[model samples]
Target: MPASIHAAASGSPTRADGRASFQKARRRASVQALLLALPLIVFLLSTFIAPIALLLARSVENKEVPASMPALSRALDAWDGRGVPDEYIFALLATGLRDAQQSGQLGTVARRLNFAQPEFRSLLMRTARSVRDETPPAWKPALIELDERWNAPETWRLLKRAAASPTPDYLLAAVDAQVTPQGNVAFVADNASIYRQAFLRTIAISASVTLLCLVLGYPVAWLLANLPATSSNRLMLFVIVPFWTSLLVRTTAWYVLLQPGGVINGVLMGLGLASHPLPLIFNRTGVLIGMTHVLLPYMILAIFSVMKGVSPVYVRAAQSLGAHPFTAFVRIYIPQTLPGVGAGCFLVFVLALGYYITPALLGGAGDEMISQLIALQTNTQLNWGLAGALSAYLVIFTAIFYFLFNRIVGIDRLRFG
Candidate 1:
């Protein structure tokens, strides 16, 4: 071989070896990075992601009837839902009810059924009590004799729906709609409807609070951005101090201050601004006040962070070129501060949507928000399925707002101090 060809072949192998070593090093670095992130990924999966997944599953879960009365549930699978099931299915239901009652699982089935139709729980309980000991010779007539509702095709359809392993009933009810006996989606009666109104009320209150925070925090943020560093740092303490206090404490403090005989009403009365104490507590005003106070700091900090980075020269140049100071500030400074405003508004609004403590304590029945209803379903009603459905909707709303914010303002540009 020629000396030059041998030299080139040797150099090519050396270059190939160096490239392989570089690739190996890069793979090692990537593995190390992944290993470092493993704990955080596992923690998130277990705590946040898993719980959300479970909640979504729970929303559609219809295990109560199937788990408690398996035979009846199995029979229900064969039901066409056109009319009541045949005598054989009725016989199975009787046996299933007897077994469920003996096992103390009848209540679970009844409760699940009652979510589909309000009178179902009472009907099931009455029938179970009647048939607890006796095996009816003819279950079809015996059940109908026990309760006229048993003869209704609608009743059987509702039962079939509740017996299914996974159902949309809870999810539909969460939005103030339901599946009819005819298997059609329809809104509930006006008087019976609540969730849709509650959702709208929640959105309205959150938007109101976001607007209030922006109005109150903007000037403060501008001041912080413009002041000397020492002065600004001192002023920032006012915004940060509230965060150090527990959220509940701040809400409770507002609860005390906004009452009929509270400091705010007292002051107004003493100043002769009002002849009597105003109804501040247990109203929408109190909810707005409490939420705005809690969220104002977030708005201020977000705006201030962006403002701190903004040069003063733009507004100054506009003013120096014969633009009015107010005009220059609005036209130049405000436009630059919008990313922060968007961040602050999105943060405050999303937070306010899930607010329970402030609204529950401060607002009246008319001012009730969706969070209160979720708490009601979980704590008061013991209806996990309904609560999960409500939570699913809230998550969806948050996600929708997040996408809208990202589209309009670019979430990547957001600043939070």
Candidate 2:
């Protein structure tokens, strides 16, 4: 081969080798980066992601009936919903109840059934006692004799619904709706419809608190941004100090301050602003005050951070061009601080949505939020499924608000420092 051809061929192989070497180096770097991130990935999956997955799973989980009454659940799956199940199913039910009662699983099954219909728990317990105490020749008649509800088609349908695993019943009930015996989706009775109103109250409170924070925090943030460094730093402490205090302590302080005979009401009555002590604590007014006070620091810091980066020249120039000071501030300065406003509002609103201790301490029964209901289900009722469902709805609402905020204000532009 000629020298030129040999040189060209050698150069091609050299370039190819360079390309391969580059690819190998890139792959090695990628592996190193992944190794560095592996711990964090594992931590997130174990702590955050896994727990959320479990919560979502628990929302639809209906294992109480199927696990405790396996035979009855399986037999009910085959039965049509026209009327009460056959005598064979009744026999399975009696056997299952006896086994469950003996195994100490009857309470779990009864509790799960009661969630579907309030009276089912007592009915099941009464029948289970009868089944355990006596051996009936025909379980259908014996169960019917024990409770007339056993003969009702609606009772059978409720049991069948509860028997199915991975059910929507909990989720439906979370929204104050339910699946009827006829397999139709319907709102619960007016008296039973609480979750929907709770959800609305939660959103309403969150929005109100966010608005209050913004209204109260904006001027303070502007002052902090405009003041000398020494003055601003001293003033910033006022905002930061409360933030450093424990949340429970802060809420408790507010609880004392806003009570009927506390400082606020005392001041008002002393000043002759009111004839008597006001109903400040344990109402919507107290909830808003407590939440706004707690969240104000966040709003002020977010806006101040953004304002620090914004030049004063813009507003000055606008004012020099014959605009009033307030007009210049609104038209020039306010728009520049919008990213911070968005960040602060979103943060405060989301935080307010999940507030438990503050509201529980300060607000009354009528002002109960969704978090209160979730706690009631989990702690008082021992209904993890309902709690999970409520949490799922809260998560969904947060996600929706996040997307809406992202779309309207652009999440990329949000500035929180």
Error of 1 at 308 (Å): 1.4
User: What is the per-residue lDDT of model 2 for residues 234-262, given as tens digits with 9 covering 90 to 100?
Assistant: 99999999967999999999999998889
- TM-scores, all candidates, are 0.93, 0.91
Worst lDDT 10-window in candidate 1? 408-417
Per-residue CA lDDT of model 1 for 1-417, tens digit only, reads 976678687775555667999999999999999999999999999999999899878999999988988888888898788877899989888888888989998888887787777899999889888888677679999999889999999888888888897888889989999887677999978777799989999999999999999999999999999999999999999999999999999999999999999999999999999999999989999999999999999999999999998998998999999999999988888888888898999999999999999998999989999989988988888889999999999999999999898666764344311
The models' CA-based lDDT, in order, is 0.90, 0.89
Instruction: Provide the lDDT at 116 for model 1.
Output: 71
Q: List pairs with backbone clashes in candidate 1.
A: none
